[model samples]
Each structure stands twice: as structure tokens, then as C-alpha cells.
Target: MQETSVTKRFNELFDKLEHCDEDEQRQKIEEMNEMINEMDEEEFEYVFTTELFNKIHEMIEDKKISLENAILLLKYIGYYKVLKGIRINGFNESSLEEKFKEIIYDENEKKDEDKNEIIFVDICECYFMLNNQFSSDMYPICAPCLLNVASSKEKKEEAQKKVEVALLALSNSSTVNV
Candidate 1:
């Protein structure tokens, strides 16, 4: 199969993201966000495959990319997946689950309340978007962080939004019961 223009553009953007410094990476991410927003469901889904997701996930795990940037990329993808009603394939859910656990359980992140809350909300939203593919174990690992965000008083509106997403995730996970 031949590569589409969208694939070429996305790859170019991702390559820039990989090679750029933090400032450049942020700029590249913004550009990528724009590109994604312009794509329809089929166009967007065609650009992302399981192998591509694994490569991005590896970048996050290897510390080659900042967690915030990585999560930003993922949240965009996850949001589109939900919006398009598409399912992800070929990605290893177990590996993602473990990484999410590490992020949620990290003491350093926990110490920074604002950052921690943002991470938790992004992650919960991602999980909610990918609800069909998640393992039962995901609920247990994510529940504590979600609960923390739900009870947080500092960012009431955002917290409430996250809480609703968390509840949706938990509600979906209950049907899996695996």
C-alpha cells in the first residue's frame, strides 16, 4: 500500500517532535494538533496504527520524550478515537497499563499537586476514550488517582469534569469483568 499525504505529514511532524528541543517539541506538538483537528475520522485513523502507537509509547517509557508532551499526543489521539467511534488495535494494553500505573503512583508527580491533577485528568480521559480495550486491572490502578481528583477542591470545575470521565471509565470497565 502507498503512503497517503496525511501519513507523510504526520510522520514529518512526529520526526520533528522526536528531534526537537522542549520549545521546538511544543511547537511541533501544536502543529500536529492542528493537523489532527483538520482530519476526519478515517483520515486520522489511517495515520495511526498499532505499531505507531507502540513506537510513541516506547518514547515515553524510554524517557526520550517529556511525559507531558507524550500525554498530550496520546490525549489527542484518544479523543479522536472516541469522537470517531473507532477502536485501537495491535497495541499492548498491559504495557500501557503498567506505564499508567507508574505515572499515577509516582511520588514526584504526587508532590506537585497541579501537575499531578492534570496528569490524572488526562490519563483518565484517555482511559475513558479507550474504555473498550482496557483491562479490568486498569480500574484498580486508576481508581485511587481518580478519586483524589474527584475530591480535590482547588480546581472544582476541572475536577468535576475528570470525576465524570472517571465514572464513565469505571462504568465501562464493570462490563468487561475480566
Candidate 2:
């Protein structure tokens, strides 16, 4: 079956990620990221569907796309949803939150120094925005990883600084709203 034009456009975008070399991958992903802002609201239903997300997840599982790029795609896709005030129809909120927990709160993943601390930070930012400015956990899921980022005082100085502020806000606000 022939896909709709919107699906095809986004598939092309994902394909760019799939096909590019390491040098060109970031640029292509950025290209797709920027294009998301330019897309009309009419296209969002197609763009943000569960099937689309499943495709991205499969791509990640298959090693067809890097986790960084997939997360970047999700972050911008999520921002566009929030900024446009459109909630995805039939999307399971818990499933997404669970996935977020797996990404952020994994103890085994946390022990690796090579793991991207910035992804933890970015996930926290994205969670707040997508959850209507609410933190998912009272203590926050990424707090352990981010706390280390702060306490170690290493290369991620900016990440460390952001973590401090986020933890403060997370602790203060999560109890009040929901």
C-alpha cells in the first residue's frame, strides 16, 4: 500500500538517518529536527502516531539508528506536540513514562561512565515539558545519574549545573500539582 505523503515525508526523514554515515548523520538528523517545526499541525496526526513511534523504536532496537538520534527525534516531536497543544490520540501515557523511567533510572546503565549524561539531562527537560511542566517522580528518575554528574565536577560542568537546578525544581514542584 502506498503511504500518505506526510508519512512518506517523515519516512524519508527517518531514512536519512538510516542511510547516512557518521559524519553526515548529525546534520541529517538536525535537518529533520528543524523540519519538524516547519510542519503544519495538519501533519502531526500522521507524524506523531503510535505506529510511527513503533517504527522508531524498532529502528533503535535493530541498530538501524543510534539512540541519541532517536531520543533527539522524540524530544523535538514531543516539544512540537506540547507547543501546538495537541495530545496524541490513543497514545498510552504510562507506556511512555515507563520507557522514560527505563532510559533515565536504570541502575546498570548509570554505572557506565561512558553513558551520555547529557541524554539524562535532556530527558528531564523533555519530561517536564511533555508532562505539562510536571516532574514524573517526586525525587526524579535521573537524579542519581545527574547527582553524580554534579558531585564529580567533571567535563559535564554545564550538565552538572543544569542538574542542580532541575533537581531543585523537581523536588519542590512534584508534590504540589499531582
Candidate 3:
């Protein structure tokens, strides 16, 4: 038979526990606590043995409860398979941030090379030097640092645009020697 997902099972378990009276909840917590105490992290993760599954199935059968409540009750037992789904299954958040930085750097390097623009201090570097913080290291800038750098960059761009427009207007107004 196809195995039900941990998340689906956990949701069912949560619902059942929520519905139970205090006495039932206390009993349920004790059962769950026992199950948790028996397993370490690795065992908890991969040791979803048939015995546990059968015990859950039996609980549903004995309770004559709806499938939802059974799931919830099992969830209350706290040994439900749903925990596997909630785990941080892949790369760490910091690794993801580093990957993002790589993409941004690749794009920026290409743009810089094409434009023949030698920026002595890129925004990342400027933010770091001025604030004594590493901004590009995993979008590592704090909120205040990001805001300050963003506003400064915006102001610089606006000034450059005004200069370019002024130069263009001056050339248009003046007669060329040609």
C-alpha cells in the first residue's frame, strides 16, 4: 500500500488531540512521551516500523473514531510520522544565501565588464567598509544597513542622471564649431 505522507498524518493527529478532553489529552501526552523517549533523532526519523504503524491503526480501530480524529489522536501521541516532513530536509539557510550571492556576483561582473565601468567600490564593498559589516556575504546586510546603502545609491544615480541631462541640454543650446 502507498504510505500516507507525514504531514497529512500529523494534521489529522493535531485535530484529534485538539478535540480530546483534559484526561484524554493527559493520557495521550503520556503515550506520546513514552514513544519519544524510546527513540533518538536518527531512529525517530527512519524507524517508522510496522509496529508503530499497527499501533496507530489499532488506536483508530479501538476508538471507532473518524479517520480525521484517529490521525489527530496519533498526532497527540507525538510519535506521528509527520515530523519527517517538517524537518529541514535540504541545504541550510546560509548556504542558500551564498548561492544567491553567487548569482548576483556573476550578473554584476558581466555588466561591469561590458560597460567598461570600473567601480572602485561596489555597493557591497561600500556597505561593508562604511558599516564594518559584510553585506554581500549572504545578503548579509542588516535592515538598517540595506536601507542606508539603497538610499545612497539612489541619490548617486539621480545625480548622475541630472548631470547627463544637463550636459545634453547644454550641447543642444550651444552652436557647434562644426
Clashes of each: 0, 0, 6
- Estimated TM-score for each candidate: 0.71, 0.62, 0.23
lDDT of 2 at 50: 59
Question: Model 3, residue 176: displacement in angstroms?
Answer: 70
Backbone clash total for model 1 is: 0
Q: Whole-model Cα lDDT per candidate?
A: 0.64, 0.59, 0.36
What lDDT does candidate 2 reach at residue 149? 48
Give the C-alpha miss distance for residue 50 in model 3, angstroms.
2.0
Residue 149, candidate 2: C-alpha displacement in angstroms: 11
- Each prediction's RMSD over C-alphas, in Å, is 4.1, 5.8, 23.7
**Candidate 2 clashing pairs?**
none
**Candidate 2 structure quality by residue, lDDT tens digits, 1-178:** 3456655676687767777765577777677777777667666665666566666666667777777776667767766666676656423343554565567666335666866667776665455434433444524455454455445545676756565555543442343234
Superposed model 3: Cα runs more than 4 Å off: 1-22, 30-38, 45-47, 64-69, 76-178
Which lDDT tens digits does candidate 1 get at residues 51-147?
6666777777776678788777776776666656666653344356456656655632455655556667667656655545556655666666556
lDDT for residue 69 in candidate 3, whole number 0-100: 38
